[model samples]
Target: MQEFKEREKQEQTISSPLSESLYENLRRIRTVFQTSHDVVIRELRIGEDKNIPIVIVYTDGLASSQSVSGFILDALLVHTPKVEGVHNPEKLFELMSTSILAGGEVKPLSDFEKLYLAVLAGETVVLLDGCAKALMVSTRGWKDRGVQEPTVQTVIRGPREAFSESLRTNTALVRRRVKDENLHCEQQAIGRITKTDIAVMYIEGIANEKIVKELFERLERIDTDGILESGYIEEFIQDSYLTPFPLTYNTERPDVVAGGLLEGRVAILVDGTPFALLVPVLFGQFFQSAEDYYQRSMIATAIRLLRYVCFFIALLAPSLYIAATTFHQEMLPTQLLISLASQREGIPFPAFVEALIMELTFEILREAGIRMPRPMGQAISIVGALVVGQAAVEAGFVSAAMVIVVSITAISTFVFPSYEMAIPIRVLRFLMMLLAASFGLFGITMGLLGMVLHLCSLRSFGAPYMAPFSPIRLAGQKDMIFRLPHWSLRKRPAMISKENPVRDATPAPAPPRPEGEQS
Candidate 1:
């Protein structure tokens, strides 16, 4: 009950007007921010006869000190402008807003809560002696990383730009790509204490309105004290909690977000995080890359097929190795079986144990490589791969066949376009290995069946996770498993966009006849 009261207090909307008396309003605001040392309250005497009293409230680190000092402080302090209407405080604030302050954005805030929130969020708020409303000036500034190449979603042929931590900059990156006027970005502030800004972006006509409404509703339901990153929003809004697979796809690439927006998908961009979340995510989209659209369809399609092939191999290879060598030796060829039997003769552990050792060792090394310093990480990954694999094989810690299988699985996991997709596969690989150890090929088959069933059952914001494959929407299948030529991809995924189906109505292209030939 105490927690509920606290939440109610935090979630209270700022609809009431500010206190009429300047002393009372200032006292109330200061009482709330009494513990905060970084907040600055500068009193100024502006307007004609220099009797008009005003106070500037802003947080120290969040706002640009230089802008406030140079533009606001200097303008009112030294170069004071005469007020035509001295008696009316409301008109004085209006006049000062228009002609007195010449720099940055200025918005009128009627509610004291809104004013204080804006002040805390880095905007300079100006309160006049008699006026009930305050002016919020744009002064947001903080040290942040500039636009850099996406470390995870890097592509060879596509644009190299990635999203930055700044919300406006990230949104601008998407806006620059999607020039359509119909593209809309709706903004909201979540987290009671942090008040993190989040934007829900989508194409007005193309994206499904029902999904957009649902997405916003879920966001509104998040009643946390703070949201540090996009991951928080993802966890709160994702459809299924039971599954490891991410229903929403997140990426640091702007071009990727723009492409999704064009395809009738909604994107959620969170402040302070480069990663942006895309809704109504599909399984096949995980295998696809940004580079696919940049290169020839044939090459892209071939690569897409390879990723899918690797997905299965990465998922089932080690399990199959354990099953075939342990339970079903007859499944292997005579010479291969003999070679495996010979290799296992000196080994102390069983086939499952052997494979488990190798996979865990590799995973540990891979993790170490990522967590360590970049230079050291690269060196460790290279040295560890060579030293560990060869040493394990030489020391008879694992069989040569098992090493090959584990290595192949690792390589296949790396082939996946998104790391988010690879993670679930990596986790499920162990379960499959356990199942195979118990029931061999039968166990493997059961594991696959369970995985497929879960996938079919999963829904990403009302859209089927395995769409164009499970429910078998024919229009959505054109770009699945294989990347049909752009011209051949006549319609968008029927599940995603029902109205904006056909993207290209033109027939396939053919070479023009010889110059002499006529129609």
Candidate 2:
């Protein structure tokens, strides 16, 4: 069985050069695409006697009809002179490629493998009679959702444009922002069946050479049949998969990607996904937002600190409440303790079970909201949560205080700048609650310590996941937990840009002083 599977893989990868006979090539291609109704093949004559046969092939919907008709067909049928020399195979091939084909991108293909790949990728292929090589012209114009405002990483004071599914468009968006000679976007294909295009973008000098090489090697090692999203690549290439914390950060905003590139982090963009993956991400990076750079340093710092606070609230709010009410009631003020006791007077379940029920209900509502139709999803989730919580409280199944704690925790989860970062927090929240339920505050403290130890041990493409904090790098602290002024962030993250850390060379800007003022 293994041998048969190996043979199948070998046959799939085998490549054969095209024959000089036009009908022979057509027969093979037709056989391969016999069941595919959208495969288009048009035969035409282009000589004085109209005896020379040529064929143009492309996918019907994937290739642009306008480009095929105007650029390729018109150039061949009307522009090319119907002369005697056109009958000669070599002469005809040279003339068509050098002059007749009006398409800006035209390349010669000698193998059936490359020809099939090109045609499938929405490029028009021209095969001339008695010519072994075929010309692949760029005519890709499939339908796509154009750049829209970021839905996931929306910013109040930054560029509103987000990446689309098209890989070329996504690269173009990043290029428009980071128009530097040092910026490089190299393309490669992954997945045997899907042949999904992957673009690795980074600034040449600023990016660490070791990290870039390691990333490329890891991508090359991926031997999957299909890669439909950036998440697939993230999973395959990430340094550690055992932890709940995300090793790679994904964002839909091009500005965010461009900023990561400028900071010496490599961006992995999958062809069909709007979210691009940025590698070597640190724990602190998730708390930082694109808007942080747009706002004044003081305001940005405050908001960033708030996000950190929210992170803890999301991860520990329910757990702390359970621990305090169940085992540490003495720690609370007398008035607060009495109020909590009153709220839980008729509650049938323990603190842990009560919190668990409320948290699970909220998760259900949140998932329902996302899966339902967008127009009504938000409404259903909001209204359903309110009604359910009110009914539960009235029936004495859960206290109003429990509902408030769960609500605040849910809100805090949304505070993370990167949605991927919030996922682990949500998962860990349940575990933390369980710990609190079992051993009160001691369990919660142990869980926190374990999470910190796990985070410190984790790595993202060889860079410490808890960088500048675990290792205590003073250089990276400028942008961690606080939004320092742009001028203050003169160097890139040491682990990411080890080759060349100096990112900014300009002197700090200063306003002009009054003429009467003296130094």
| lDDT against the true structure, each candidate | 0.88, 0.91
- Model 1 lDDT tens row, 356-442: 999999999999999999999999988998899899889988888888899899999999989999999999999999999999999
What is the TM-score of each predicted model, taking all chains together?
A: 0.94, 0.96
**C-alpha lDDT (0 to 100) for residue 451 of candidate 1:** 94
Q: After superposition, how far is residue 101 of candidate 2 from its true place, in Å?
A: 0.4
Predicted structure 2: clash tally: 0
Lowest summed lDDT across 10 adjacent residues in model 2 is found at 7-16
User: How well is each residue in 185-227 modelled by candidate 2, as lDDT tens digits?
Assistant: 8999899889999999999988889899999999999999999
Worst 10 residues of 1 by lDDT: 7-16
